[model samples]
Target chain A: MSPPLAPPGWSRWLVPPAALSVHLAIGQAYAWSVFKPPLEAALHLDGTQSALPFQLAIVMLGLSAAFGGTLVERKGPRWAMTVALVCFSSGFLISALGAWTEQYWLIVLGYGFVGGIGLGIGYISPVSTLIKWFPDRPGMATGIAIMGFGGGALIASPWSAQMLESFGADPTGIALAFLVHGLSYAVFMALGVFLVRVPRPADRAAAAGGPSAAEGVRVSARSAVRTPQFWCLWIVLCTNVTAGIGILEKAAPMITDFFADSSGPVSASAAAGFVALLSAANMAGRIGWSSTSDLIGRKNIYRVYLGVGALMYLTIALFGDSAKPLFVVCALVILSFYGGGFATIPAYLKDLFGTYQVGAIHGRLLTAWSTAGVLGPLIVNWIADRQEEAGRHGSSLYGLSFAIMIGLLVVGFVANEFVRPVHPRHHLPAPPKEAADVQRQQSA
Target chain B: MSSDSSPPRGTRNGLIAFAWVWVGAPLGYGLYELVRKATQLFTG
Candidate 1:
């Protein structure tokens, strides 16, 4: 379908904020860890029980994004963003009610299930529209929007912590925080809804003035799934994500273990500093590395992300805890690659499949993230817990996990090497029936 | 598309500035917190 075009003289630059508005708000999901202790204490729940909300939210994010991607593409960003705004805001409000009532299951149902759908839909809603707006610089364009997701936690973590502290950390306080979050995010995301516009057909045509790499292949999301390229990229994304998330999911405690026997053990506050640095690295890498892809090419950048990433893991495995500086540098670099892997993948899809259904394809691809999210932390935490049980201390606790991460990165690197352009056979064919209907309408 | 006309320089600059501010406001706050935390860890 010919999408509605932006008005003449509409600045393409305005679109990223619209995307950022939604991403930054939904990105609050990453900060769910901030609520764990408080929730556990207040609700008289265990660690696993408290974590169910976050875990279920993530699972729902992937599921909704995968299923609703086509809807985002079909209905346009306005429809997608509005749905996201409602689902996301209402989820928070519902969770607030659950909190007030002291119903843990309601909190789980509201935040995990309903809020997660918001995350999924909100995440992919602006992607395709941004690419369409910035055909000239798809990498940079997408990086700008997606970087907000990474940055979201940086904003929410401290803010949420402060709110919980000030509000008293009881059920009443928790409900208040949830209420504030829901209300504020609804206002924040509405900016995107109103500001976002599809490039007019004429503008789109004008924007594609010359034949370009993005015009090379046009694959629908369904067809993209059939291609080896898609699956290869999936493996590449999943493995890379798994490796990074492994360390990230356990950063604070892992650092303390690494330095437990050192001249001075790393303090809890210092470990928090380390985590904050990793978050900085993740956010910076999203923008910096993805923008670099615009210059170096997407496939080549993945080589750096996967190849050098594995080497970074190897460096840490060999010599990490010996020097705190070395350990920090390697960990920061690896985390950056993780963030870059996320920010770059949309542009990578644009490269291989054209813009036809890139958003849908990107949505479907997020299932890999959900998979890695589970697998990565499990591998790292499980091994770490076992090592602690067995009287292992210091770097040895994570040495084995780091080695496994390196192996995963190598697998990703190999998969990246195997990625070639999608075959022409997978490209979407023009539908004659739609063309005839349009022609008949025009004649009438 | 390369064929699309660029918006006026003043308008475009204004839009770019607005876009950056929109995304950068929260990011700047996050950075502030990170810096504050790091400072506390190192100096305090």
Candidate 2:
């Protein structure tokens, strides 16, 4: 309940770097798939068995984020960051032990569940705090911090792969790799916890624009759910996530297969590099694309995302295994947009509803991610897997999946269009003055 | 342009606006796409 302290001389701009350090490190979750094939080969596991850790990790990310939203709002960013550091690092430790012991369930418990809590807490921690620091530009502040999440994999994918190769790619080697990740990240994320500071009362006073400022709206968490806007956004995010993750989870293999029949096919090393390129695109989109949303208005920007994204999915489906460059370009563009979406949504909510409890609102909204995390992959993977079983190769297996993605985008488009201005009726009256204004106007 | 040597209030506000725009725009575009693609899956 104490007022946050301000720095002696430094302006608030210093905080974004503090938030990014943790995000970039934890965002390494995207790079996790890089180790999948090696682990499978070494352990003699099937594709489904090999994918268990990743699947469980995704499930935990959504579930924990959904459940942990209020706790995060009540506790400040420091506590959340501390929990994230311990849980995330512990996940790696537990998984490392699991790897050494050759117990898959232990790996699931440690890496998937324990590590997942870290991912969720780290994601939400600095969001509202950053918004408070730069109230004039919530989108940009959150974007810079959140961008680290998408981009984190850019460092991890290749680096982890090298370490695995150097240490040996077998189970014991994998255990060592996990051990290093756990220890190193603990130190890296701790720096963010130390650096982060909530905006001081004066800054909040300045940013909140005083009592005379636009009577800022506050929506309770329980009531926010009742509004049509929340459901519309849920549909919008769920579909976007479903479409992007389907491709992301299978990026390496999908790229190789897509380019296989082309005149200039992607080689094995190139395929791995290609996933890295997508990581770059994902990272860049988080910074470049979402930041763009600040100018165009959130709704208008989403129109472009949904509309253009569907076209990109269609291009890949229609083009099939054709020009190699076209395939890469389109996939990169789509991936960038996917990253952009993750970065921009916080700002979008801030615009629609004032900053009151937006971090919690954003947390509630992430249930869409949990839903899509399962649904997107299931739709795409199941279709692709079944078709592969049916002897469908080349572009045939993914055609149905791409079409499904398009359908999801269209549904989101309708929901986006449906968003009306949140009426005064939906808001609680501003303290006294606004209520007096209403009384005066009515008497007149 | 103002004849006065002093910076105008409008100019300062504009600069502040531009800073916010630069940072927020890309993320706005990005989240819009996320929602678009999310809904697209079900409709199609």
Candidate 3:
């Protein structure tokens, strides 16, 4: 169903919370790891087998967002949120069935494929609308919503762990946990579906008349992909994500490995704490740094994300495990930049291509994330594995991987430098009078 | 546009407050949980 246009004086402030509801629900995907060990034990599967659902979910997230983006833009946020709620909640229900029946493939099909589509659509659903509503502070507005996605795991992780602790991690308990998640999230996400409103044409026109309106080259998603600027952004996102996700994916193990020879080796619980700390940094960065981008400009902020991010890697590499506090601080800063990069990109796209099809454009850009999802873990894990085979231990095990990440950040830095405003040639022409009239009529 | 045709000022303010709280409470709980967990790194 198409969302109704906002009535006059409808507070734009209401939009972020509406956006957050869906984001917070879908963001539970990040906590998928909490289920991995239990799934492995229950199904008698290997680590790789247990990881399949999360991997496929990530892959599906990118593919569906890329394909369904135009549809989401066409249908509006209310419809998209409704669809996400249905898909996400049902996927969990289906997984519950699979767990109860001891069918691993069914769980994959349900959680990975169905739930992943929900993640994709839900992620971009409110982004363009937020940008439209808060023309003056697009970065901060979108950041607030996107931060919910990063922070979602903070809620889901502990909640899921507590549930498993209570439920015994057996198949019956797993099924019950999934059932609760599916039903509860359905109720929570319904709030967003009901609350979302598109800006009225009159309201948009009034906003456009203001100084900070995002008015410029109006590139369609179809045309945006053709521009050099888009590819540059693709590189920028991919590398930045790869660098941060590498450490993130390996955070616990990497920290333990780094400090193996120290005066006090990091215990498993402390390593878990480090991962939790990184999550905090990741969530905080999404809001804090993205709001900073609104003030400093998107391009300049990327310079910091890529440039200073590389320095953090260098510090970790040089100091190794000698200094625990230094290593932790550097890792926290790098994770923050990672979260900031995700939050700030929509505003960056708005600056370059305008908001005509920004959600769709943003959808296409997330293919970079999907690619990084694979590339990051592969680089870190493969290097660490080789180091182990070679009998290397302690901090030396990750030095080469750290160096490679520094190089990747440098590449992203160059890519950010290459970005420029989209050319006028790529801009969509103004709608003809008849078409405009018809649109106005439909909106009215 | 002026606030002329908008809902009553008190109604609008109340809705905004409710909406923020709806999302904020959960997020606050999550942050508190994370901070509690993160402290183990320093303490342990």
Q: Among these predicted structures, which one has the highest lDDT?
A: 3
Reference contacts reproduced by model 3: 0.61
User: What lDDT score belongs to each candidate, Candidate 1 first?
Assistant: 0.86, 0.74, 0.89
Residues A1-444 of candidate 1 have per-residue lDDT tens digits of: 234357677777778888998888888889998889988999999998999988898999999999999988998888888889999999999999998999999889999999999999999999999888877778888998888998788889989999999998999999999999999889888888877888754454446554355654679998998888999999999998998898798898988888898996788888888888888888889999999998999999999999999999899888887888888899999999999999999999999998878999999999999999989989998998999899988889998898899899899989999999888888766456534543444454
After TM-score superposition, the amount by which residue A104's alpha carbon in candidate 2 deviates from its true location, in angstroms, is 3.7
Each prediction's Cα RMSD?
4.4, 9.1, 3.4
Tens-digit per-residue lDDT, A311-373, candidate 2 = 988998888577766777888887787777788888777766666677778888988988887
Cα deviation of A263 in candidate 2 (Å)?
3.5
Model 2 accuracy (lDDT, Cα): 0.74
TM-score of candidate 2 chain B vs. the reference: 0.55
Q: What is the lDDT of candidate 1?
A: 0.86
Worst 10 residues of 3 chain A by lDDT: A208-217
Quick one: ranking by DockQ, best first?
3, 1, 2
Off by over 4 Å in 1: A1-4, A205-209, A430-444, B1-19
Off by over 4 Å in 2: A1-4, A7-10, A34-46, A169-172, A205-215, A252-262, A320-322, A386-392, A425-444, B1-44
lDDT of 3 by residue, A186-245 (tens): 998987887788886455555544323245457999999999999999999999999999
| lDDT score for residue B26 of model 3 | 84
